[model samples]
Target: MRGKAAVVTGAAFGIGRATARLFAAEGAQLVLTDVDRDGLEVLREELAKTGAEIRTVVGDVSVAEDAREMIAAAVEDFGRIDTLVANAGIIPLQTVLETTPEDWDKVMAVDGRGMFLTCKYAIEEMLRSDGGGSIVCLSSISGLAGQSGQAAYGPAKFVATGLTKHLAVEWAARGIRINAVAPGTIRTERVRQLADEPGGPEYLEAIEKLHPMARLGEPEEVAAAILFLASDDASFITGAVLPVDGGYLAQ
Candidate 1:
């Protein structure tokens, strides 16, 4: 990844943050974006200590202008975009009856529409640059198979995975590779909170048992998969969804 320019969205925390750190350590210059201004700044300060070229833009991916600026910033800062980790997303676990119209729209706005905007602008930049690059979007096991409580979240990830395949075929002749990572239950802080909710412990225990590994995954594990798809190692791969699910999806 040395000398490569990359961009990571929703990079303030979880898989996004871990991906940024790994990218930096692997010698990629980066532009990170997220709605969390403070988290972005703080992450930048931390990554800077390692002599990595890191820049942050505060924006919501669902907003067109913000998404555009995020890609533009990468071109302006690092000269070209070699890779993009379109990881900004939100998951609201609720049954259809429990879901409100407004909140569902909000989830679609960010997780579904937001990813579309980011990929659109990022591909535009990559197309205009020296050569085509790789794009790794974060999908989920829910997108692969339906979940009981992910009425809205599952569909949004489906959109992301669908976009990856369409663009991978659409741009393959141009040397562009687009793929997605469908992660199983990753043990992030957000999941911990979900586990702490009412009856959540029992819920999580049951969830964990469903996995053949009988354990949740880690953010770094997903980040590692994202890195592989972004790096030259996956040169022959595109339009594919890699499952980092502790064999949960296999079941």
Candidate 2:
């Protein structure tokens, strides 16, 4: 990834943060975007210690102008976009009965439309430069398999999963590779907070056992897989959804 210009949306924390660090270590110039300004600043400061060339865009991915600005930053600042990690998303664990119309819209806005807008603009930049690039979308196990309490989230991820394959086919002749990573339960900061909630510990324990590995995965673990898909290492691999799910999907 050395000398590559990469854009990672939702890059302030969790899988996005981990991916940014990994990308920097691999010597990629980065454009990181997220709604969390403070978190973005902290990440930028940390990466600066390593002399990583980075820019931050504090914006929501669901908004078209914001998505355009993010991709623009990469091209204007770095001169080209070599890869895009469309990692911006929101997960709402709710059943259809419990989900209100507003609830459903918010989830779809971030997880579904967010994926489309980011990919649409990023691919445009890639095509404009005539330098086809790689795109790694963040899908989830819910996108592949039916799960309890995924009424809203699962369908949104399905959008991500389907979009990945379609876009890959759309641009395959142009050298742009598009794929997705469907992760199982990962021990992100958000998940860690769950342990502090009532019944959260028991809930998580039960969830962990469902995985064949009987453990939650770390953000860095998923980040590694994202790196592989985003890099040339995954050349010739497109439209495939790789599961980073601790063998959960295997079962």
Candidate 3:
């Protein structure tokens, strides 16, 4: 992806941050965005040390206008869009019966609609460019199956994976390739903090047992898959949801 232009949403921390760092290290010009302005600046400064060509957009992916401006900034800075990592999402851990309508909307807005808006604008730009670009979306293992406390989050990710398939087929002739990564429980800072709460360690232990590997995954592990899907290394891959799970979905 040397000299290529890439955009990553929810890039202030966790998997998004790792992806941004890896892409920059690989020589891609980057447009990193997040709702966390401070985190965005922190990451920007960190990347500065590498002398990478990067720009920061502190905006919410759930907003349509923000998504447009993000893609616009990438094109204005780097000439064309080559890669998109729609990694913006919020995981709400609530059972269906306990989840309120407002919660459903919140999860849909950030996790589902956010991906749509990003792809809508990015695809528009990709079609207008010389050759279409690659798009990698984040889907959770909860999306592939079902999880007790992920009623809202799981359904939204299911939509994400569906959107990936529908668009990949619709835009294939237009030269755009789209795919997704289904991650198991990743050991992000947020998850770790949550695990420290009362009864949290036991709850985490239960989750670990569910995975054959008896461990949670790392943000960088999933980021590696994101990078692959965004690169020409996955030239013939599209509409596929590659699992970055540590055998969680296998059994």
Query: Which residue pairs come into collision in candidate 2?
Result: none
Candidate 1 residue pairs in clash (backbone atoms < 3 Å): none
Off by over 4 Å in 3: none
Specify the poorest-scoring 10-residue window by lDDT in model 3.
194-203
Give the residue spans of candidate 1 off by over 4 A. Answer: none
Cα deviation of 97, candidate 2, in Å: 1.5
**lDDT of candidate 2 over 142-243, digit per residue (tens):** 999999888999999999999999999999999999999999999998888889988789879999999998899999999999999999889999999999
Which prediction has more favorable lDDT, 1 or 3?
A: 3
lDDT leaderboard ranking: 2, 3, 1
Query: What tens-digit string does per-residue lDDT give for candidate 3 at 121-239?
Result: 99999988859889999998987998888889999999999999999999988779999999999988778987778877887889889989889999999999999999999999999
Judge candidate 2 against the unseen true structure and give its global Cα lDDT, from 0 to 1: 0.94
Model 2 lDDT, residue 39, Cα: 98
| Alpha-carbon RMSD, candidate 2 | 0.7
| Model 2: residues with Cα > 4 Å off, grouped in runs | none
Q: What CA RMSD would you report for each candidate?
A: 0.8, 0.7, 0.8
**Residue 95 C-alpha lDDT in model 3:** 88
